[model samples]
Every structure is written in C-alpha cells, then in structure tokens.
Target: MKQPEIIFILRGATGAEHLALEGAVNLEARLSDPDRRRALVAGFYGFHADAEYCLAPWLEPVEGLDFAARRRLPRIGADLVALGGKPAPSRERPTVTSLGYALGLFYVLEGSSLGGRVIHKQLSHTDVDQRGLSFFDPYGDQTGAQWRAFIAVLDREHAAGRADSKEIVAGALDGFRLARMWLTE
Candidate 1:
C-alpha cells in the first residue's frame, strides 16, 4: 500500500492537540481586551523563543529552507513589547533530537500561520491597537507561497529518507502540547 503524505499524518496525529490549543487561545475573548492581547502575545513570545531554539540545530542546515528567515521569536517579542508586555526571562525548552522531530515541530509552527491569517482578520475588526498585529500576518500576501515552500521542503526531506512520518507526527503533537501549555499559562 502507498503511504499517506507526511502532512496528512501530522494533521491526523495532532488534530486533538491542535483543537485544544485553539480553544485555550480563545482568540475572540483574548482580542477583545488589551491586557489579554498583551498576555497572548507574551505567551507566543515565550513559546516561539523556545521552539525556535530547539529547531535551529536541526533545520538551519537544510538546503532550500531559509530557517533563519522563518524565525518568529523576535517578531513575537516585538509584538509583546508593542502591546505593553515583556518577554519572560526564561522558558522550558522542548527537546528535538532528530531531523524528523524538528520537521514535526516546524510543521506545527508553520501550520500556525494558516490560523494566524484568520486571527489577523478577526483582529482587524477589533479596537485593539494594530501595532502588535504583525505576528498574526507575518507573510502578508505571500502566506500561501511561504507555506507551500515549507511543505515542499518537508516532502523533499521525507522522500529523501531524511525524516520519518511517525517521528514528524510525534513532533507535531509535542509542539501543539507545548504551545497550548504556554498559551494557557
């Protein structure tokens, strides 16, 4: 039998965690309040910082993938500050020991941009100041193309035997867990 695509595998394995995280984020409630918005951005800063640090070693060397440009920690931090919050002095780092695991983690991070686009649209209708909204729409008009590029890289890696679907799914689950924990805390 032919194997399922890695993206499909990741989406299936991470479906529950992703839903839980979305519920915890409660974008409508959070976006309605300035304090809540700052807190949300701060939580994202913390999670992205740790996630990026974990992914660097594994993803940085991947050709055709500009991992450095994909880093969101800095933009998240800027968003937090713009929203009148500060980054935590430290955060718990998730362990990502393999390329497959890193790709799994990245799948979660990159996939978030899809939701971010929706959140960005929601925020547009809110009274919240727009300065910190950069995190929600980092790619602007290029979001689809950027996502396709990442997916291409993922497919290439899997086809080349550099990553395993199971490990990638596990990484995605962990990523969702980590994101939910930080966001809800």
Candidate 2:
C-alpha cells in the first residue's frame, strides 16, 4: 500500500499548493456551514442534488440554475484573496462564445498538465468514491512532442509570474468544495 507521504510526494506540485489539503480533513464538514454556503452561492456554483458543479465560465451545457433563487443550491468559487492572482471572470450573462476570451483560455483549459493522472489516482479505487466522478477532469491527447510544446507555454507563464502557487491551491479547493458541499448541505 502506498503511504500518504509517498502519494503526496508524487503529486508534483509545490507544498504551498497542498497547504489546504490538511484542512480538507475538516473542510468537508465546514463547507456545509450556512455562511460558507452563502459564500459559495454568491460565487456562482449551481446545484445538482448532491453535487454542485461549476459551469467553467466558458463551457455551456451545464445542467442547473446559475443561482440559488430558493429553487437551487450553490457553492463557492475560488477565494481570490488566497489565490494571489487572476480573479475569476465576472458574473454577467454574456453569450457563451464571449466567455472563452473573457475568462482566458488558460483559465478554462490546461494545455498539457490536465489533471488526468492526478484525478485518477485520487478518486478512483476509493471505497466510497461514487465512481465515474471525474467527468470534469482535465484531459490532453497530444503526442509527446506536442505536449512538450504545450507545457513550455505553462512554464513561460510561470516564469513571467502570471500564475503562482496560491492561485492554483485556491482554485483547486473551490473545485472540490463546489462538488462535495452539496452532499453535506
């Protein structure tokens, strides 16, 4: 069996990005608090029975109301304060076509480091996993050469300081919180 530390070491991100992970042991319950719930709703998570999913700011075809409105539940988006840079796109209802540019491609799509292996390792094979839970998981199918070229872009962005550890951590939390809070609340 793999030890927790071993898995953590394999995650390939810096420690700062995983700082909140310790809190997740408790955050699952805290995420249900009414205040946090309100924060989530205000942040634009739409509800579905036991899961609240983000509409990705650019991907349409999401299957729920955009607001709580007494008819649905909501979840929080990233806490930009903690994310360190790059705020989420605004809440206006411009056409979906406009959203890709409005939100920026990097925010919506990962070129090479799509969370594929990570998602599989984390949720698959867990006892209570509900399985098939990663419909929103990131994916990329380019050849190795193509992938290398793509990762170079993320590297450039990082070198330029356009992206950072804090933003990655906060957004990852928002993603899971938006999903798991539904079961608790």
Question: Highest lDDT among the candidates is held by which one?
Answer: 1
Each candidate: RMSD to true structure? 2.5, 13.5
Backbone clash tally (model 2): 2
Instruction: Return the lDDT, model 2, position 86.
Output: 29
- What value of lDDT does candidate 2 attain over all alpha carbons? 0.31
lDDT of each: 0.84, 0.31
Instruction: Give the top-scoring candidate (TM-score).
Output: 1
Q: Over the stretch 127-156, how does candidate 1's per-residue lDDT look in tens digits? A: 666777698888888888888899888888
Error of 1 at 170 (Å): 1.1
lDDT of 2 by residue, 51-117 (tens): 2223344223212212222112211223222322222343332222332221122222232123433
